[model samples]
Target: MIPRVPRLQVTELVLDNCRSSNGEIEGLNDSFKELQFLSMANVELTSLAKLPTLSKLRKLELSDNVISGGLEVLAERCPNLTYLNLSGNKIKDLGTVEALQNLKNLKSLDLFNCEITNLEDYRDSIFELLQQITYLDGFDQEDNEAPDSEDDDDEGDEDDDDDENEAGPPGEYEEDDDEDDGASDLGEGEEEEEVGLSYLMKEEIQDEEDDDDYVEGGDEEEEAEGVRGEKRKREPEDEGEEEED
Candidate 1:
């Protein structure tokens, strides 16, 4: 049956995994003038040239697609877009960050598991240009897939009882068996590496007059050593995340 477009009332549109190759975005424009959310994840679209025209779009997700379109087009078009997810694509360089300057209202950006090799390259200044954005996933990777759910939404208590029987008893967390890094304590004696070299200086010298060159150099050396140790620990976690990707 051919689906007729109703009067522009669509607030959310999801075409995920549609295997759509052509840019049929124009079809929706005629019927979805009020569209507030749009998703074409894992679909076969490459650019955001057609989307910026959607003046009412608030959230857009086009991840896992082969998009090489310059970030300039996205920034120019979706000026009002607040949430954007472009991870799992081939967007590598930080030029996109520059293009996103027009997205002054953007609140969240997900470039996680992407081609950004070192976050330090765009950590403070470039990212800060997006003043409205509060959260950004620098890793360029695909997000976790949610588990399956039964679609029988109108079931009554009888169905609940039947489901209970079919699913068996309730499950519980195996808390005792799940001990890894362990929780960090933050009370009286909570001095870890986060305390920094300043902690050692204050402990040894009670007054400000004791800031000797030897003590200052020692603090600098220890701080550098501590930073290296932290980086070493972080590298392994990054590798694990890569494996998960």
Candidate 2:
């Protein structure tokens, strides 16, 4: 047993499999003025005579019931209905579905497993009869797949995409920072190599200067020895001249 909720606040209701011989549920009436969606499948409902007038109702599901006729009440009661499911019911012919033509806002209708589906040119005839319906039995007139009733989910997915797009620039900025860090590290390494090569060149120049100084000192010593040899030869020549005299 479901507890009674505040009728004014109720926007959606599901009473599937709740037995109601005359298609009326206790406490369900025009008092639920805000109701937008309703499901009463498998409820043993034989008629829509007792159904409430819900001007804002957009979706109604009465599948797997004994609802043989009286669909005209739907247009009068729920004029704004955008979707209606009468599958597995006793709808037998196109005329039975013609009652829905008054529902100008109806976009989709499902009558699967009904006797009317077995008729020749069923899909074509229905599309022709209900020109406003975009989908019959879950397909469009062009045989294209119909859109599902997950509008909120689609909005959520679009929000997620927007969030990702909003955060994209920050994510790219972080990657750019990482690249700049890498370039800074390479610059530091190059600086270190330059410092090391500068030290090595300084050491090589100092060693060359020391070698030049050593070579100059050795040449001065050899020149002094040659002068000393010339003086010795002159002294011997002078002694030989005195002896000859």
- lDDT tens string, model 1, 1-245? 97966647767888898875574343444457778789988887776666636677778888888775567765665567877888787776776566787787776777766776355755464455666666666321233332221123335656889988886665533453244224333332356554756787777776655668669989999999999999999999999999999
**How many steric overlaps are in each model, in order?**
7, 0
lDDT of 2 by residue, 34-143 (tens): 99999999998888888889999999999998888998999989999999999999999988999999999998999999999999999999999999999999999888
TM-scores of all predicted structures = 0.50, 0.64
Window of ten residues with lowest summed lDDT in model 1: 141-150
Candidate 1: where is the Cα deviation over 4 Å?
1-7, 22-26, 117-119, 138-245
Q: For residue 181, what is the lDDT in candidate 1?
A: 24
Candidate 1 residue-wise lDDT at 202: 78
Supply the TM-score for candidate 2.
0.64
